[model samples]
Target: MKLLIVTPHFYPENFKVNDMAFELQKRGHDVSVMTAIPDYPEGRFYKGYGIFKKRRESINGVKVHRSLIIPRHSGSSFWLAMNYLSYTFFASLKSLWFGIAKKYDAIIVHEPSPILVGIPAVIIKKLQKIPVHFWVLDLWPESLTAAGGITNKNIIYPFEKLTKWIYDNCTTLMIGSKGYEKSICNKGDFKDKIEFFPNWVEDSLESQKMIDVPKLPKGFNVVIAGNMGDAQDLPHIMETARMLKGSNIRFNFIGDGRKREYVENYARENGLMNNIFCLGRYPLEAMPAFFAQADILFMALKDTPIFALTVPSRLQAYMSSGKPVVAMINGEGADTIREADCGWSVPAGDSEQLANLLKHLSTLNKDELTQKGANGKEYSRKYYDFTKCINHLEKIIGTGL
Candidate 1:
């Protein structure tokens, strides 16, 4: 199968779509990616990427075409809007031209957010009369209201319409969470087209050599990896840390995002520095090493209906690391921890419950904690296997052998 993946992010930006495109290419399919200049959590173009620099490159065997986009400087609402709109405008134009020059059997839109990425795939689909598979990793309008804090319907209505149009035009909708089905169906009659296509643990994470990180403080370490953003509910995590102060538990944050500075300041100002350690972001390959030193893997999301439906990608990574999980999250993510019997979960933003759970977990012996970790590893293998997921994707895109 000849496939083209249209996404707002790609390699050098650290998204799951990178793994999907590479895996498809590895499976005897010709896969190419259309993306923007690498700028993400840092909110600035990567050191060597820009409009005129390295616009076209190849990674492994997959061809990559990058479109010019405004960097999300400071990740403020204004800058983020510019970043999203720039990609939609430039990628759409690129799609029209690229669609004419290149032939592809199907176009996969790797939509993590700003459903507008589908505009380009929809354009190419119209030009070539081919299938457009939209992998919906985040819900629109709801994310704006939930995470972005945009409440005015007058402002959100347009995005809601755009979201529906994108959903209506796509040949297939691959939802990252089953909880999203109801939301997509509410937008339109997409019931027949919707498929549950959850994120898988990266194969690299499964086999990592432990590398030394900043010496962790002596105690039961709770490693919180991934983006520290509004959606992550960092405020409550800090509150939990404060409540657990003077205990053996320590919260180690291992990622950077919009709220990273705020988290750092909160820890310092409140004198919670001893209980919290902001280890900062590290390369993806180095995460398992950090996980190796953790007594528990912590994850959380703000208590919003939209977030409740989200099964954060980090959850799969943590479970795959063969570590006990502790989540201050609701809905799907919380349910997964319970179903796997991997660890404990508390309501999102509930510092009291979270602190209490950590206290109890600290009391558990090494063997008991290891059992929970083992349960998660087994469950991840059974349900979130990467090979099985890619196989399902092949069938969805009509490329199944």
Candidate 2:
């Protein structure tokens, strides 16, 4: 089977879709993914790549076609919209012209935001008579509004209509959480086509089995890793760090995004320099060792209704690393941790509540923490491993073909 994957984020961008495509290829399917050059979240081009014109290459045996795009930082909504639109246009044109000869059996379009890439997949699927699957990373318009990225009355209606159109047209739509299905199905009026497909943790490929955990800071380490954007409400975490000062616990934020400067500023103002450490963005490959080094893993999100239906990808990674999580988040993400017995969750944005929860963590014995971590690791291996997740995806692709 020939599989064509259309996503704005792919190889060299530290997105999971890269490993996904590789898994598909290893399964004996001919898989090729088309994407823009490796500029994401920051909108800056990677060190060696250029924008404008398509570049073709292969990474670890998977065929890749990189199209030109107007890169913009994730925090800047206007430029980000332009960036997605430009990639949507050029990738569609270039793929149709240069890639049609391969005759794809099925097309998978990853929907991170805006449905830009999915629109192109819809066109190609309609013209070529191939089945198209739209994978929802996050529910769009709603998520955009939740993140305060865009709320203009003039554009909201059109964007919502476009989202409904894409959902209506795709042969199948895969959402990352069960909590998201109802919202998407309601919007698209296509309940039969929507499938619950949570993001999985491919631990062996993405993380190293700890021979031994690395040396921690002077106190117990509570590490939060991944993007520091508005959606995460990192300020609350900073406040929690301040509250933990002089205690036997410290906070380390090991990722970067729009809120990086804000977090740094807050740490400085609160005199948390010794208690909180900000490690800039590290590549996806280097994350596992860092995860192993932590005494507790942290996850949080802004207080928004839409977030109730969302789960951040980092949760899977954190759980798979055999670390107990402290989730100051809402809804599906919180539910997952609760169900797995892997962590504790407090309401979003309440630093006092989060701080108290952190304090409770301090009371847990090493054996209890290890038990929770082990439970999470076991659950991830059995239910949320990429091997299992992608196998389900492959079956869907095969059925479509």
Candidate 3:
């Protein structure tokens, strides 16, 4: 099958879409990507890319067509909206041109966020007369408010209408969490279209180099290794660290985000320097070793109604790394951790419960901890392997998942 994946982020941007494209290509499908210029996280063009440079490229034999994208200089809602709108406009225009020139069996729109990408995907679907598989990685409107990106309810109705319009057009709508099902099913006639398609760990996860962490303290390290942004609810995690002060457990935060300084400052001001170590950042390749060294992997999110229906990608990565997790997140993601018997979970923002869970996990012997990690690894392999994920995609391409 000739498949074109439409997304705002793609290869060289460090997203699961890169691996998904690779897996599709590995399966002998002709996979081409249509995405924006790489400007992410730091919100600047990457070293070699500019607004005008390198518009076309190929990765691992797969062709990538990059559309015009404006770098996000600030987190202002207006700029962010322009970023999404301009990317959607240009990507759709370019894709329509590409659609007229080339034919495809299916089109997969990797909707990680900024729901407007569907506008182009829908246009191309109608023009090309092929299946449009909308892979919704995040829920809109709700997510915008939940992530603190946009909070004005008066402005949310348009997004809600747009979200339903996009869903109504797609041949297959795939969601990463079952928690999303109830919300999406409430939309018009979507019951038969929506399917559960969980995210998967990278195929190269085992190849991550074993880097040493010389500064890491020698105790049970509860490692939280991802973006420390607004959604992480880091204040609660810091409070948990403060509560666990004087204990042997060390909280290692190993990522960069908007709230990194806040977390670091809180740790310092409260004399939690020893209890919580704010290690800045690590390359993706270095993550496996960090997880390997951790006695328990830690994850958190703000307690929001929308977040309860979401699962952070790190859950799959933690499980794949064969590490037990202590997840202080909301609903389905927490339920998954418990169901896998991987580790414990506490309600988001509940410092006391998180602290207690940590103490309970600390009481368990190393062998018991290893068993939990092993269970998580086996569970990830059985349920969330990329091979299985793409095979499901194949079935969906043939019919629908």
Candidate 4:
């Protein structure tokens, strides 16, 4: 099988696309990625990446084609638009000029963002008559408003239409959460073909090396990994840490995002710096051991209806680490944690209840924590294994593997 995985975010940016591409390549499919320069979470271009010079290279047996992009986004909504539009626009041109020319049995557009990333896939689908599956990670229009990226419905009208076109045109739509499925279908016409496809941790994460791992500062660590955006309500987290001032629990935040400054500043100014360790971002591979070092894994989201459907990719990572979770979110994500008996959960934005849960967790003995962690790992194995996930995805894609 020959596969073309299209995405704006890929290697060096730590998107799930990396794991999927490698899986396809490992399975004997000639997989090639069409992506722009890496600039995400951090906003600026990474080392060895540039705006102009287009390049192609082989990464771990998979061929990768890079395209030019306006690499300035991450923090502000203005730059966020530039980041999305710039990648979609140029990458579309790149597809027409180069990417679409390749012979591909199937096209898989891995859209963790910007529905427009599927533009190239649409062109390839129409021109070559190949099937293109759009794996939508986030719902547009609603997400734009949720992220405070775009609020004006008048200005968002065209984008709304665009979203409908993309949804209607794709061969199949894959959504990670039932929340996304319900919301997306309500917006337009996609109720028939949509399938549930939660993101899974790569099978490789199970083999985290035991030695020479990254060290934590001190205290019982309750770590939250992944993006630190406003959607996360990180200020609330800072306040949670503030409330737990004299406790043994230290809130450690890994990964970078727009509100990271707030996390740092609030921790420092409020005299809780030692209690809150903003360890920042690290590579995806390092996450297993890093998570294993923690006493409990943390998850939080804003008090939005859409976010209730949200489950961060890092949740899978945390589950894979076999650590008990302490979640502060609503809806499906919290339901999953509770169902798995993985850990405890309080409602989103409830600092007092959250503090109470942490206190209760602290009272639990080591053996109890270990059992909860084991349950989470077992649940992850049954549900969050990429091997099983991709098997289902390939069937839905109907590429005839």
Model 3: CA > 4 A from native: 74-76, 149-151, 207-209, 212-215, 399-401
For residues 1-401, what per-residue lDDT tens digits would candidate 1 score against the true structure?
99999999998989989889999999899988999999888988898888789899999899999999999999999999999999999999999997799899998999888888999999899889999899999899898999899999899999999999988888899988999999999999999999989889887788767666787789999999999888889989999888987888999999999998998899889888889888888988888888898999999999999989988889988999999999999999999999999988999989998888889989988998899999999999998898999999999998786
| Candidate 2 local lDDT, 194-238, one digit each (tens) | 877888875553455544333558678898888888888887888
Off by over 4 Å in 2: 52-54, 95-102, 205-215, 399-401
Ten residues in sequence with the least summed lDDT for candidate 1: 207-216
TM-scores of the candidates in the order shown: 0.98, 0.93, 0.94, 0.94
Alpha carbon deviation, residue 236, candidate 4 (Å): 0.7
In candidate 2, which residue pairs get closer than 3 Å at backbone N, Cα or C atoms, i.e. clash?
Answer: none
Best candidate (score: lDDT)? 1
lDDT of each: 0.90, 0.80, 0.85, 0.81
Better of 1 and 2 by TM-score: 1
Error of 4 at 355 (Å): 1.4
Worst 10 residues of 2 by lDDT: 205-214
In candidate 2 the C-alpha lDDT for residue 40 amounts to: 76
lDDT of 1: 0.90
Looking at model 4, residue 270 earns an lDDT score of 88
